[model samples]
Target: MEITVHSSKSVKPDYGDSSNGDAAFASADVVPLSVFDKVNYDEYIFYVYAFHPPSPPTTVLVPALAKTLAEYREWAGRFGVDGSGNPAIVLSDAGARFIEATAATEFAGSVKLLTTGDKVLSLYPICDGAEELLLVQATRFRCGSLVLGFTMHHKVADGPGMWNFMVAWGQVTRGVAIDPVPVHDRTSLFARQRQDSPAQVKFEHRGAEFKPRAGGEIPGVSCGNVAVHADGEEVVVHRVHFTREWITELKSRASSNRGGAWSCTTLQCVAAHLWRSVTEARGLGAREATRIRVAVNGRARMKNPPVPEGYTGSVVLWAWPATTARELLRRPLRYAVELISREVARTDDAYFWSFVDFASSGAVERERLVPTADAAEVPPCTNVDVDCLLAIPFAKLDFGCGPPFFFRPGYSPAPVAGAIYVLKSFEGDGGVDAYVPLFSRTMDAFKKSCYSLTPPMADARL
Candidate 1:
């Protein structure tokens, strides 16, 4: 399990092409953080993809990375602030950090390397600073396997945005023109420009994305981003696989009690299943209130001037669905599915604009609010937090080499919070892959009930 670093350097974008030259982004050019991006200013997302040895060499890969950055200039930019002191990305072409490393062992025997903590994390570059918006590490094994790891600040882009960037990079590596050029205009796409009073807004913005001020706490409820873990607890990021057939059956079971009126979507069914199983695993009291935070994309949901297809920025919000353990577990699966569906159904254009309006009202800065991810830490299994990334075309991320055999976070975010990231499995079996982090104490219970699609009998113990 030995890893040796061979080289590390900043790869600046190559603006050789006059069409999109570096002059477009002067040293002072900056992109202000949108309302969606501001909330994730303190967060960083990590990912790792494994490829077989016949992978492209650094000679081809590094240049492709720099060429790709020319188009994705924002990634090579550094963090800064605008005149009003709001968070912004200074497009100064500061360059992204890239490293080349070698591993002493084979990829198959590297399971221990993927266990947890600093071991697997070593594969990715450290992005806990403002100097670099994107950091990448390429680790090569003796058997010709390569592990590509990268980290990006959440404020720069969310899951969908990152996917767009990665797919473009892959296209560049293969010597193809990047299809569907990225749209960097976040202000107009996600921010509200029209003048509007906070009182005119429909939904209550306080205590949702922004933390409420004095005397605004929700009695006993915690923020959606709040997660608490036991002292010295061992958290493991485990994969829970749900085959296509399993999901189909689960959908059937969830809609069985609905009398054919409506059926739950794939995510709704899967999320409900996860929430119920995690609640049982935690062994929460029957009366204890538990909630699941589901992430909803706002790209297609926005209208007027609909969000462009390739807008690269964070535009996602959470849909919080809550119920007592007794009700969530005792009721039919459809009950939990419906609760989630209702929330997601309502989180549309109006809801997104309302949130934008709240931010535009200066309330976010006035209240000195902090996002839940920046709030008190907790275990993810304590309350399920689900983000579905199934639509990300991971299989199509070919870089002259074959598609990646595996794609996952370089390291689990278990230490910070317990969470689940659902992605498409690389097995080509149409199975769903859920990257879940749970405390060792409840891992066994979760594994036992994770695949069970049916609701337990009212009197049955999990």
Candidate 2:
């Protein structure tokens, strides 16, 4: 299909200032581009696919196309990054193509279905030299459908920031003005120096070298299978909320066993539930070893003074703990929670620096990192599996559109077996929404378990 081109914008040239007695592109001014730059800025991408009803009329798709164009124009005005220090907005040919193609493909890909996954591979330098801050791509299928793809650098924005941009795009497409443009706040969550003494390491891990026993592909269910075939029905997202009381109880339970180590109750409980659910779905007994990793932010954990909150820089960290299924099930949930909590804490200490040192020391071959069968094996897991917590408040992210139906997390290459969970706080309800991606079969097992378990016990609170 011939995709039409729309309007484009670019950041003002003067935005980046080499003047004022400062060096060009101070480390502070430029957003860190690498995941290794910091711990808090975990790299991730979000994608949303809007599938039209089967055999939809062309007339209906035209209005959708116009709306999409308008939305891109407004977004170009709001967040374009200039080459210089000052933040200026600019739209590029690449950006325009990405937006127009996505709209056009909706009618071309014969989508019948859509999906997204975490892009775990390292990012290479942009060779195109486009002013666009995001890499948007779309693929059309033989069956009149489309898959819209967006690759955003974490330093430029977080999940909340990206959602804000989406909201603006949606509103502009609908021909509405966004009220009270969102403010970028960089003062609050400044990156702290490593010297700041703390009681214990926030997060810790066991078996950093543990590799998975199985190497090749294993026959399992796909997302499409679970969404369409498992029970032979359409799959719709269900937003859920947990009472504050439940959060408190979970925190209390986790803290009780750790001798009061600082741990995020939300992270601990969610991990435990997912681990157990997957084991049961695979019909693997609790005794089988499994490995899970949580991505952590390294902003405050750095030895350097904390970076200002609005500082667009890369701040990401990853921590993994591997254990046999038998041990995970045998231990109290609190134990697992403590393990996660401790691992998070340690990132601020010398251990975190050691990791950085090792990674920078030399060019490590990918094959060496790949696990062998005889190697002390741990169940496989990837960053794509864990739900990344976008620390920014959702309410703070306003891009013109009032809000979104839901903010889903997506990736490029699918993970081994689990799904990526994207968390967003609803605008009016003050509730948390998690976009979970799982194998079609696993989702089926999850639903069945939810239905069979007693109501109160089945609650995520437990």
Candidate 3:
């Protein structure tokens, strides 16, 4: 797809009805970076949306949308990226970004054919500068479907925070009051006055063992049965669609065999199913060690001064569940679901509150803490990793023109056969779109073995 940039400029915060005289929103020009925000440092979390608006012939979409977004706290916050690329956000004076670009493609086709590494992603100024906390890009497709998206430094806000801002932007476009107004007081997790000791703040994330393990061979689970071989160009991106009906059917099949008061969430079911299927496709043996890494959002659960309803910051923790390839493949899907559900349940107020002190004390220099009720279960070996951004309301974001039908995270950090990104379905049904990158052979096997792609089976009685 060909694209051309029109204009790019910094947008200052507009303290209009949204501010409500709140000091964090109205007066505080410099918002201090919190522990979670700083941990991400200079990195960014990107979002892309495909919007089919009513006024297709109008030419003022970008400017109007840009104006609507820059008025809120989440957008106006500025990042202070020192030479090291670690970002800091200012509260009020910091401006967001306004970018206008034109894509030489139809909107629907653009959404269907989009990929993380495609050239169409060049429209955004992701690598342009470090000072801006929020960057906005509006691409007018030839078919008049506008693709609106933003890139926020991970330090400024997490996934939920980012979506909150986007939804609020939508509210503004509809001439409605912003509900659950953004509370930029990041002190809900950390104190504003406490100073970070110069030597205490560290950036390196490594293991805590006396001797960190070397070599790619993970020993917790045997690897003889592994079939994963996606590397370099051999790896390809493919999406597996799971309808609500099929998911419910799959979950029932797995849950029926297990006896417990607890059940699996949709996300747990999908991720576990993918893990097991991918492992099977890669031909990993039943005994080979396998692992899944999940990033959990810690907001409503935190106690003491709970993170406010509209607080925007990177409030997340990574939880890992390790199992043998046999356990993942042979066991029912609920087994993996149980592991994930339990892992997520372990993250509570104490865990996050402890993290505040843990981050400030420079404990990461010694070891990375994996919060779990059963720490004994954590494998002492390398784990196959899958990054998940599920359940966040991406498809629900409606900017007065109805909700977006497609949402793509823009980029992938993992190599081929190395990642799993689950989001809402393309049809906006009660389903999921699992964006996976696997090697050619593995993906082929996955297509054959995984029933997630098939249509829902009709009931026998029906």
Candidate 4:
């Protein structure tokens, strides 16, 4: 677990576009934050990729990263405040922080365990404050295996965008052309329409997303049966793997009782399964509400001038679905799936526009509000949020030898509960992996409940 840091430095873009022969943002420019980008102003996303021997060394990887950053200019920039005092990225070629380190032990057999513990935190470069929008660490093990770690502020890009950037870096390392050039103009993709009036606000942002629902007394918000976690409770991440057959069965069961017209999607069915299981494991009161915050991407939902596939930035919102514990347990799996599907369907183009308009309305500042999606702001115990990374092209992220044998969220020492990250299985068998963070006390119950399709039977056993 010991690591020795050999060198640390800021890496600027090494080259410019071949066509134009000019570096992007050659002169410093400030890119204003869109409504979506402002959601995670203080949060960062961490990624750890384990690469075995015969991979590109730091000598080549670092330059490839610099080249990749040249194309994705925002990653090489630093955060700053715009003229309006709104969060923005200063494209001043501030350079991303890169560190080269060495680990004494071999990394072949211990990728999973090494990443699960707090020691994994050493793999990532320091990203605190406004030091760097993007930071990377290359840790070479005794056996020549490399553990590449990346940390990017969520304000700079969402999960999909960051993944795309990672893929681009891999493409650069392999000397391949970067496919699907990224579009970084946040104003065009997410800003409120220029024709619309500034005062036009469609949704009640305070009630729906930000502020508490007029609860002068109740400690929990009913949005998704949100309740406070016990103070000093230990939260641990428990991973549950679903094979293709198990997923198929879950989907079949979730789709069984529903009308012929309403078959559940993969995400809906699996999320429902997890939601029900987690709720059952918690053993909440009959009247206690439980809800799951489903993360929905706004890219495909936008209309008119549609958001490009490669558009980069945060354009994600949560779909909150709630039901009482008794009702959830009493209902069939299909019922829970229907609830999830219905709520996800509600987050259409209109909903995204409403959020964009609401962000610019000055109401957020006036009300002193923050989005519940921010993990720091989320109510710890009763809340369950799901982030799906099923579509990310993990296999395409081949630097030289092959794609990463394993990839996962970097370990955080903080106690976070009820967040499930649905990822594509490393086996590439069309299966799924759910990394569930829960109170350590309920992990055993969750492990048993997650595999049971019949909630009644599962609850009885628990």
Q: Highest lDDT, which number?
A: 1
Model 3: per-residue Cα lDDT over 1-462, one tens digit each: 777788787766444434364654455555566767655424555677777756332234444444555445556655554344443464545567778888887776655557434543554556444567678887778987777767776656777877777887777666677766777776444652444422222222233111232335321321111222322234466778888898988778667755755567778888777777777777765556777777777786676666787886767766667788766665667678889888777766666665666566645445544223111132322343455666676545776678776577654222324456787776768787877766666678788766753322222311
Tell me how far the alpha carbon of residue 369 in candidate 3 is from the true structure, in angstroms, after superposition. 10
Q: With candidate 1 superimposed using the best TM-score fit, by how many Å does residue 358's alpha carbon deviate from the native?
A: 1.0
Which of candidates 3 and 4 reaches a greater TM-score?
A: 4
Q: Candidate 2: lDDT over CA atoms?
A: 0.40
Q: Please, what are the lDDT tens digits per residue for candidate 1 over residues 1-462? A: 788999999999886762443343433378888889877536667888888769999999888888888888889998888788878888888899899999998987875446333467777776544478888899998888989888887789988888888888888889887866777876666544455523246787675677644434322221112223435456566678889999999999998856889888889988899888888888887778888888888886988558777787888888888888899989889899999999988888888888887777877667777676443245234578887887776667888777788776643233333477878876679888776777778879888999876675355442
Best by TM-score: 1
Q: lDDT of each model, Cα atoms only? A: 0.76, 0.40, 0.61, 0.75
Regions of model 3 farther than 4 Å from truth: 16-20, 55-78, 81-87, 91-94, 115-125, 128-131, 191-235, 259-262, 285-287, 365-390, 394-396, 412-417, 452-462
lDDT tens digits, residue span 340-447, model 2:
667666556365555444433332233233212111121243222465564554343222223322233444223233544635453334334444444454566654
Task: Please report, as a residue range, the 10-residue window in candidate 4 with the lowest summed lDDT.
Answer: 218-227
lDDT at position 356, candidate 3 = 66
Question: Which of candidates 1 and 3 reaches a greater lDDT?
Answer: 1
- Which TM-score value belongs to model 2? 0.53
TM-score of each: 0.89, 0.53, 0.77, 0.88
Off by over 4 Å in 2: 1-23, 26-44, 47-150, 153-264, 363-384, 400-405, 413-416, 425-430, 450-462
Error of 1 at 103 (Å): 2.2
